[model samples]
Target: MKRNKRKSDEMFNLDDIKVYMQMSAKDKLYWLERVAKFLHKITPSKNKKIWERLKERGF
Candidate 1:
């Protein structure tokens, strides 16, 4: 079944794309790949340092 899109899900809207535009090419590509594989609509930015911290926290 499909789930409802929440405010949290809405957080991944176009503004997130704006934040992504500020990143370097490699960083943006890395995140683009990650988000492409993400199952949930709530995907994080394509920033490696942030991903590293998330991994460190066991995300």
Candidate 2:
């Protein structure tokens, strides 16, 4: 029998949670803020519809 290996993208480890749990309160908040900013940058804005309409009219 052969064993299967997980690809890097498909691999997940619980050690990350353990490390997070051991972080200081200040460190945790700092990481939280960083994550929030990252998410905000990746997300689209609420004015998407207006942009779409303008593009459709050759703007």
Candidate 3:
């Protein structure tokens, strides 16, 4: 038997967000860069504006 799951728009959990908010500045920057790099990789080159901007700024 299969179970059904209800989908909602709550993509982020408040508790998780609170923990992330408590992370130190260096940890926050590390996570931010990781997410940005992941986004750049997954997003198509044509839509990779952030990567292009970063390149222009000498990343």
> Which candidate would rank higher by TM-score, 1 or 3?
3
Candidate 1 lDDT over 1-59, as tens digits, reads 12344576575556556677788999888887887777334654567668779999999
> What would the per-residue lDDT of candidate 3 be over residues 1-59, giving only the tens digit for each residue?
12334348766666667778889999989989998899877899776776689899999
By TM-score, the better pick of 1 and 2 is: 2
Deviation in Å, model 1, residue 52 alpha carbon: 33
lDDT score of residue 29 within candidate 1: 88
TM-scores, all candidates, are 0.36, 0.57, 0.62
Ranking by TM-score: 3, 2, 1
Per-residue C-alpha lDDT of model 2 across residues 13-52, encoded as one tens digit per residue: 4566667888999999998999989877876886666777
Clashes of each: 1, 0, 0
State in Å the error of residue 52, model 2: 19
Q: Candidates' lDDT values, in order? A: 0.68, 0.75, 0.76
Model 2: residues with Cα > 4 Å off, grouped in runs: 1-12, 47-59
Window of ten residues with lowest summed lDDT in model 1: 1-10
Best by TM-score: 3
Ten contiguous residues minimizing lDDT sum, candidate 3: 1-10
* Ranked candidates (lDDT, high to low): 3, 2, 1
RMSD of each: 13.1, 10.8, 7.5
